[model samples]
Target: MQNMWKCMEDLDQYLTYVGGPAGALALTGVAAASAFYLASRPSPEAPLVPLDGQSILQNKDTPSGPEMIRVSKFYKEAKNGKFLSYFHEDTKTLYEGFRRGAKESNNGPCIGWREGPGKPYIWANYNETLLRAKNFGSGLVAHGLSPGTQTFVGIYAQNCPEWVITEQAVYCHSMVLVPLYDTLGPDSCSFIINQADISIVVCEDDKKANLLLDKSPKSLRKLVVVKEVRPATYQRAKNRGVDIVKFTDVELLGAQKDYPQTPPKAQDLCTVCYTSGTTGNPKGVMLTHENVMAALCSVMAQLGPHKPNKTDVLLSFLPLAHMLERCCENAVYMVGGAVGFFGGDIKNLADDMRALRPTVFPAVPRLLNRLFDRAQQEISGSCLKRTLFNMAMSAKESELKRGIVRKNSLWDKLVFRKIQEGMGGRLRLMVVGSAPLAGNVLTFARCALGCLIVEGYGQTECTAPVTLTVQGDHVPEHVGPPVPCNHIKLVDVPEMEYYATQGQGEICVKGSNVFKGYYKDPEKTRETIDSEGWHHTGDVGQWLPNGTLKIIDRRKHIFKLSQGEYIVPEKIENIYIRSQYVEQVFVYGESLKSCIVAIVVPDVDVVKCWALENKIPGTLSVLCNNPEVKQLILQDMVAWGKEAGLSSFEQIKDIYLHPDPFSVQNGLLTPTFKSKRPQIKSYFKPQLEDMYKILM
Candidate 1:
């Protein structure tokens, strides 16, 4: 242990030196961390499977309500003696039963929608979709394929039924589905499929098909096309004379159906949504059948979980390639709820939401933040609504502080009622996850919509949900206690630490719901999981006095100051980004020195606000490059960064504000919102030189 400690200390220093020229600045962060680690207490073992963290927590304090919140019951319709689970009467289990019902109801008064262009969700669960997936599942399975049969089945398509159906079909048949984001270019997409040993290809368009054939391995046994913009791409794929065809052709060959064949048992592999890391190749996260199902259980364990019913409808607009949306798809299917698909484009999302009038929604922080900004803009535009909304929001915040959701008032009708209508009159809840949402966004949502807006946190590695705050139990400071059936532990690392534990070190988990392991990488699996089976999530977290977990930041990302105060850059950045003008921020200053610095990107719409105010705008895109706008943002960042993050290390030493937003097309941000740290740093290396020169 002593030698091990020495080795870790040496490596830690070396990392500080090697992280980049900025790494030397992290020396203060390291010394502070070392002292803090010495002062913190030893970590306790994470509770075992039989034990419930929530139960232990509540018992220690004043017990909360029911031990579990079951969305399973919501999935079924009430009947004579026994209720039918979310699907048709003939259905057996929650897994296939809902799908079966959906298939039967297809083209039977089922509807599809997206009212206009720039509308996000157009067709979520149209009749043709369910029917196609049922056939699609059986078709692929007939080829002697199942989940985990090959490493992956690439679902590369635009936002359409083909994407959803192919994903479900892959899930039903038990093949590890890797849904590739369309925005991810040919290089990243091809690399992921190859890394996962994708056996079956469900390419959406001809462009993707051509790209696949060009770079794909000879071992790729089957290729099927779905929706495509250019027909020539298909001919290109066919001319390869290797092995590939359109999806329709695959369907023709797979005519028979042993439908719902052995619904994937809990232990089976589900999907592997690869995520960006401090990179070598992107890691294929192994999520199990039960891992997904456990997400429902954990959600139910929270307050006011999803309520699935025939009348309930969900807006499927967020990228289905994402886990939160994917899991919502499953939960909605189980409930026999209608899914309204938003158009592929984000610009179209708002109109789509209004037309769908969806009863439920699962959204990312980015979406929620946009909504918040829009509502604020809407209010600013109308004085009558603005005054009422401000007063209502103030009252709502007070009630929420006490965990009491106040009854609706006349103010809602007079002011924000249309806001709710735009989201669909049926919206009972809008789950916000994927990243930390601004507190103001949360406040505005609860006040404006009067619908439940809960937050959750997870990664592609955990199959998308680990902790969530239920509707009634919404705690603002912490994310939430661990969901039921999840064993969340803070492992104490005496050497490399960030979360004080107030004493614990690394956050760890041991659960059947944990992924089987990274696909085809035994060494990586061993490194992630220890001898006792705990998966070491590189995140740093500490237990609050109330027993809830507060995540500090990625352990590797946290740094310190001369006072031994470890500064969590992401946390500080999350606060800085709360500014309405700031779209995104990347904090820099690892070991080198005293203060933090940031690279800032202004929100397009927010910048338009400035143009409108000055009466000097062309369009949102045009106004982004306005020199005056750039100068305004730089001044704002200096004040906003320091104020939000506190002083000392949190203060911005200098900033490099850019008119352009980071995007995959531009090679700035990953598909996931994580900034490509090295890529961004390199692209702006010269800018950093200017920043440091000025700061010094």
Candidate 2:
């Protein structure tokens, strides 16, 4: 006690020597703050809590001789000889689901859109939207579109009210909906039209209608223009014996007569979605009504408490032609949530978000990465701001570790409020899919946006999502357990040395959600789906200890170096693209070579900024030819590869900086934003050879 008093006396003397009572009080406050910060920080030794249920191994025999893995609910149900096919008992078809949603929400907003830039969204209530859908269906009947599963209705447009109306109309008439996008090009569009035997197509505008007429599909007999029909387009269509009519006129014609609704059976075909193939012709994935409903139910079941409600709003920007966007929109519609589409321009997405204030946001990794890069650039200008932002992120990350998400916390209010507001302040949930998001970007999005961000894994054949990250689970890399509708198992790829017993191999899925077959391609369908009904996804995945799935490599994209080491170019490209200097990258390797090389599309703004800082002068095209600029990007990519723990063979040995990006228009990238490997290699054959020669 006497010694403690002596220490206190010494402290008081030190405080007095430093300043006075004010200094003492300031030091005390600092000590308290430090203690609080330490307390709130996540413990280094704390165990990570598992976010998903345990995977139950099915004892049933499989073709590959490995036990299938399934979630407990599904395993139990299968064991009991029962399976879930729908979320709601009465919701058999998409049309029935929409009707149920309409009845539930009543006068609530169903779909909304903006008239022009900087304008508030105009909403159409559930009943009104349903009525319009009916009118449109009747109009189709008036135009000689027969109501049956055999009838195919093509919709070539971006996401708009008209697209949804057309889709619902097809559902109401028991017709198959075939979606087409401009990115697919005229040849592919014409092929789809002829393949589906489509007589009439709903075009977004005159350009699409004219493109269709120019292609002159053999089956096309009429053009239904959502926007005004141009005189030239009308004349061209008239010359081809194809009738051109406005969308409103079709609705008016339908309203004149009461067309009986012909809802499709559960097993009836719903859509023939064509994939954005990397090579050759695009394959049409035929999904039945049961297939789509099962996927929708599984997604909703996985969402659990975070499922969309009547009050929720989703911003529709991703192409409606893609199954991911289609499934997400259908999920929203199934629950009576409002969907507001973008203003047809990706540049204006932020403005649209601000106007819509969507509660639920579905995004792709490309956009999230851009947002992350923008935030980093903003903070790079000020060291003090950067330091505070880092501290705030650290605190939020600690809270996330404890499974807590807060939007009104002190750090959120001060540091992340602007980020939240930028994405529409009401955002409570975000679903990211279509590609694997960088772990750091995923973490930053969750922390900065202060919302439940989940990543899903799937493809067009599965009708959208197969697995989704669990809500309130902030772990980054792994896509969570399989949804209830499907059972997941890994098949050994002996050539790649990936073994199912070791929990690493090609992923295979079997469930109600699997598509019926590839449209008109029985051989391709048979190749994709094995005799046991398992769809062999070409993706290689590792089953994490927590029963989650981490995508490791793609079997189809895997190649080997001369040294006998296998390399996955997509994985390497994903790593290199993390470098701020890179915008898009195509990593190429020859089996005879010892190392890989890359064709990098440099980020123009970042490169210019770096050039200006270094006192270099050149336009982007000129800079692409500069040796120093190439070295700069190569060094940065190498650094990123090293940081990512990539092997020596995986590290890009050399790089060619290209000013022009690989895009759909250039035919070097697919419509889905995947690099068309053969085309890309052909396009840059000389550059690629030159880089290897320099390395030699």
Q: Report lDDT (CA) for all predictions.
A: 0.58, 0.78
RMSD of 2: 14.6
- Model 1 C-alpha lDDT per residue in residues 26-137, reported as the tens digit of each score: 2344345334433542332222222123323323243234221111111121111121111223433334544554664453323355545644433445446656666777
Q: Against the true structure, candidate 2 has what lDDT? A: 0.78
Candidate 2 error regions (>4 Å) = 1-54, 60-64, 72-83, 558-696
After superposition on all CA atoms, what RMSD does each candidate show versus the true structure? Answer: 17.7, 14.6
Per-prediction TM-score to the true structure, in the order listed: 0.65, 0.77
Write the residue-wise lDDT of candidate 2 on 1-696 in tens digits.
011111221232222211101101223444454466566553332222245543445554543366456553433474333345797778988988888788777768888899887999999988888889899999999999899989999998778899889999999989999988754667888999999999999988887888888889999998898888678888889999899888999999999986999988899999999874434577899999898888877877766677888889999877788777788888888888889988775546667888999999877665565566666766776665676677678878888887777676656656677778777889998888766777898999888888889888887888887788876567888888777778888888986789988889999988888998899999999999999898988989988887788888777986644332446677778888899999999999874455799999999999999999998899999999888899999999999999976756578888888898888998987889888887898999999999889875
Number of the predicted model whose lDDT against the real structure is largest: 2
Cα lDDT over the full model 1: 0.58
Number of clashes recorded per candidate: 41, 0
